[model samples]
Target: MPLGTVLVTGGASGLGAAVVDAVAREGGRPVILDRFPTGSGHDEVCVDLVDARAAEEAVREVSQRVGGLDAVVTCAGTDSCGQFGDVGGEDWDRVVKVNLLGTAAVVRAALPDLEARHGRVVTVASTLGLRVLSDATAYCASKFGVIGFSRALAVETQGRIGVTTLVPGGMHTAFFDGRDEQYKPGPDAKLNQPQDVARAVIFALQQPPGCEVRELVITPSVEGSWP
Candidate 1:
């Protein structure tokens, strides 16, 4: 089947923006949902995914504006790093709310439209979800929750809708703006480009109805190890 309309959360920048561009390049109508303007020609829904009511309203408004919904890509996520015992309660809560609960809220809002169209859902998780990282307890926990949630959702949907979890290693994006300098990936490290992960999302969306690419883990070949 030809690619149709796609809705991308966090589409203002990073992997989400790349996914929006990829979808547009492939002749799909792409709609962006984010807190800021991307300045792209595609429709935009400005909302904070962590705000449940706003997220739901934005999804409904986008679905109506687009006439129908065909695909959803949940790319809105954030990470925080701290030793389990050192991280404050508020910090942990904020990370989990944005990375885990926020994603679930977006999916809950979009599931009806996805089921109605038998559309695909591509969620951008992290390689950390599959492996543990020291000092990143909250981030790892949130991503692991995402992976589990996607698996359960896939089972519940049971072929009525396609669900995919995109687990990618260190990307060349500004996800670590305020992190301690030592924690950042080495400059020599060949981090995956945002576009690389976006391409994976496109690939998942292009699958046939009878097929589902349940999970994909992508790491840079130069990394030489699983992230």
Candidate 2:
């Protein structure tokens, strides 16, 4: 089925941008909620995801402008890579607020519209969500929270809304651009392209009614991030 009007957080870049492009290709209208303009000419609600209230408001605003939402893909994410004690408190907390709290707020606000349409939600988690690593306390914590939240939400909204948790491994995007050298992927590191992972998201979204993809883990074939 067509994706209908889908709201995508972080739709300006990375996997989110890829999803937006794919959605358009599949004949779905893509609406964006991001801190920066999408520049894609689609409807957008530009707001920072750190403020849960603002994120919630943005979701509502998008729904109103688009006439309602048929699905939401929460792809907005931030990370502070450092040892628990080394990362500044505010930085660490911001990661949680944006990655975890923001996702909840957006979904919370979209529930009414989504439930009305029996919509789908795809929350972007990470391989870190399934496993642990050193010096990535904030990112790991937030992603792990997403996994738990998505699971419970699926059960809570069973038969009313479809929820899918996407645990993606490293991808080729600017996600690692500003990181310290040590935190960046090695030159030869095999990472899946954002478009590849976006295709998986499309797969999940295309599932017919009464059938849903509860969780998806897409990684590079040789990726060492997962077990």
Candidate 3:
């Protein structure tokens, strides 16, 4: 079977954009669900993922327009760095909403279409989800939630839908652009490229029926966060 129609949240940039490009190159139709417009003329549905209902609606919209989905990659994520008590409430809350809740919303919305096609889901998690760091309460909490959620989801939907949780370390993307100097990766930080991690996503999506890549951890050799 072909790659078919796949929905990628946050497909406007970073790892998500890389997956979109890879999916298209492999002959699959990549539908984007993002807050920003791609301007590339690809099939897209622009919506803020923090709004679970709106995210769900966007998935339905894409599924209907594309004639059903074969896969969905929840790559949308955000982080607010600072001491737990230092970060503003809204910023902290937004991290959880966008990372943990948004992932669930998109996947839940895609479940029906995925079940119909025996489709795949690849949810992006972080190394922070496994190891804790100071001043990273919001990001850690949200990513940890993602870890738990994806694991349980895999068991619950076993034999029906393919679920893979991608745990990646720091990457060379704009994900750290607005961070404080202390929070930003150091000048010599060995970060993997977003495209590299994205290839792993394609690998999971391409798994043959009756086979599943349940979880993947892709990080740079000297990744500081993973250890």
Candidate 4:
């Protein structure tokens, strides 16, 4: 079943973009709330995820434009890769603000519309959220926060709406493009394609009511991140 009026953050690129394409392929409506426009023939609101208030307002605006929201995928994320003390304070804070706080803000504003429409939310966390790594304090912290937030939100929302936390391993995306060589995946390292992972998201979104996909972990067969 196609998700109606789904809003996706960071839907302009990477996994979020893949999910957008998947939703369209499945004949679902995908609206984008991102800092850039997602040219997928869907409505898009250009808003910075790092600003909680702006993120919330963008979500509300999209809900209003679409008439209602049936689902939301919080996929906008940032990272500051360096030893804790080496990373700048502002950069590290932005990672947390965008990945965790922004996710919360979007969902926070969308909840009323979601509850009324019985919508679902899929939050994109990382395998690092489960297993800690060095030189990634900010990313790890934000993702870990996402894990906790998603769990708590599921309980708080209860029957009003559904929430799923997607714990994905390393993927071949531009997420690592500008990172230092040390932060990049090795040549032989296995990583899932964003499109492949997008299928998992589609599956979660298409499940029947009362059968919620509360949590999901998608990783490559040889991915070393997950133990």
Best by TM-score: 2
Residue 58, candidate 3: C-alpha displacement in angstroms: 1.2
Error of 4 at 30 (Å): 0.4
When summed lDDT is taken over every stretch of 10 residues in candidate 2, the lowest stretch is: 57-66
**What clash pairs does model 2 have?**
none
Q: Report lDDT (CA) for all predictions.
A: 0.86, 0.94, 0.92, 0.91
TM-score of each: 0.95, 0.99, 0.98, 0.98
lDDT of 2 by residue, 196-216 (tens): 899999999999999999999
lDDT score for residue 183 of model 2 = 97
lDDT of 1 by residue, 82-199 (tens): 7889889888887888788888887888888889989988887888888887888888899999999999999999779999999998888877777888777777978988998898
lDDT of 4: 0.91
Q: Residue 6, candidate 1: how far off, in angstroms? A: 0.9
Candidate 4 lDDT, 66-178, residue by residue in tens: 89889999888889899999999999999999999999999999999899988899999999899999999999999999999999999999888989999999888989989
Error of 4 at 189 (Å): 1.6
In candidate 1, stretches whose alpha carbon ends up further than 4 angstroms from where it belongs are: 224-227
lDDT at position 66, candidate 2: 85
lDDT of 3 by residue, 25-84 (tens): 889999999999989678999999778889888889888888889898988999899998
Ranking of candidates on lDDT, top first: 2, 3, 4, 1
